[model samples]
Target: MSTFAVHLSYPSSPPGMKLVGKRYVSANAQQEGLPLVFTHYTGAHKELREPAIQKLFDLHSKRPTPAIRKAWAFAGNHGEAGVVNAGSLKSETNGLLHSLLSTLPPSSVSYRAIMFVEPSLITREMRLKHKAERRIAPRSCAR
Candidate 1:
């Protein structure tokens, strides 16, 4: 039997639905660093249609026994909007992540926080990294 790592991310919480865009990242896939399962909806339009997305969250929230809870969370940033829109896909994804994580057993990995950011947005932000942690940076460079 193989052990998998679980990670969750989401966009919004419907009135009856708890987790919405939760992702289940894996722990084994070397290429993944830590295996992850996260949901990504292109825009708000997708979030409005919550049935399929919420079901996805419910699926991940279930502990499969063999898997270990590594880490999980929700996070986002606003570009033009002055106030961060909690209703945005990015924000809702984070909310679902929180719900999925609540089901995990207490462990060291559970204590660590997960970062949720738009890949494109991060590129634009140009976050600086120190020499030692360069390996953590994404493979592609801007130029």
Candidate 2:
């Protein structure tokens, strides 16, 4: 998640450098950037990750094509902290989500804190939609 945040928080890569395979690789990364990029996404859902796949393309909209959009692997998704749905509010997660939200602005960092501290094979896509929001951290955040 931090990788995704850092990617959005900064400017694009330099010429000849491309954001492939989660790192700055040569634009000619033919090896990693074959006809398709095969990656793995892990999370909570136990079904085929269609939305998760779509969200992957949504997040990395650098120069996407229909074929390029056809992802093969690599994803790690979760909910806004412990709040996966309205039902989550009925459990102890209720108090936790409220407290965490009160303290941190809605961001992946905060979400990661409440849950998703480890990598998993599960893939769960939250039905809630979060419009893309990219920004520079405030100076106070630097300290």
Candidate 3:
């Protein structure tokens, strides 16, 4: 499990670098090129959060993909804190799904039981479909 932070910034913009005395310092000071807006995962559940960040980065790098744009719009609609909570819930749900799929066969009754008990996975799937539909729909179309 992991926690991640996402930022929206231009791809070409240099990372938050500063000249401290004679030394230049940045988060990835030794590495060249600007860091992606959504970079690094930390916390006890960071492993879970990392993939979400990676997915967002993969979608948003160079230009904002539809999913990225939709996420941004979601944040805009819900507020920054709401987005953070949503991301955390999504990550946790993914971790649960991964654990379930990796440890249990599809035919296992326990697996089916857990899936039935946890509505988070179902909600996440519905949200994914909603995002996909939003992405496919033209911008001018009202939802």
lDDT values for all models: 0.34, 0.29, 0.31
Q: How close is candidate 2 to the true structure, as a TM-score?
A: 0.18
**Over 4 Å off in model 1, which ranges?**
1-15, 18-33, 39-106, 110-115, 120-136, 139-143
**What is the C-alpha lDDT profile of model 2 across 22-99, one tens digit per residue?**
322222233332233323333432123345545544544544432222333222222321123334334322232213
Query: Which prediction has more favorable TM-score, 1 or 2?
Result: 1
Q: Against the hidden reference, what TM-scores do the models get?
A: 0.24, 0.18, 0.22
Candidate 2's displacement at residue 16, Å, is 48
Number of clashes recorded per candidate = 21, 11, 4
Poorest lDDT segment (10 consecutive residues) of candidate 2: 1-10
Candidate 3 overall lDDT versus native: 0.31
Which ten residues in a row are the worst by lDDT in model 3? 17-26
Better of 1 and 3 by lDDT: 1
Cα deviation of 71, candidate 2, in Å: 2.2
Q: Is candidate 1 or candidate 3 better by TM-score?
A: 1
Off by over 4 Å in 3: 1-44, 64-119, 123-131, 134-143
Q: Using lDDT, give the best candidate's number.
A: 1
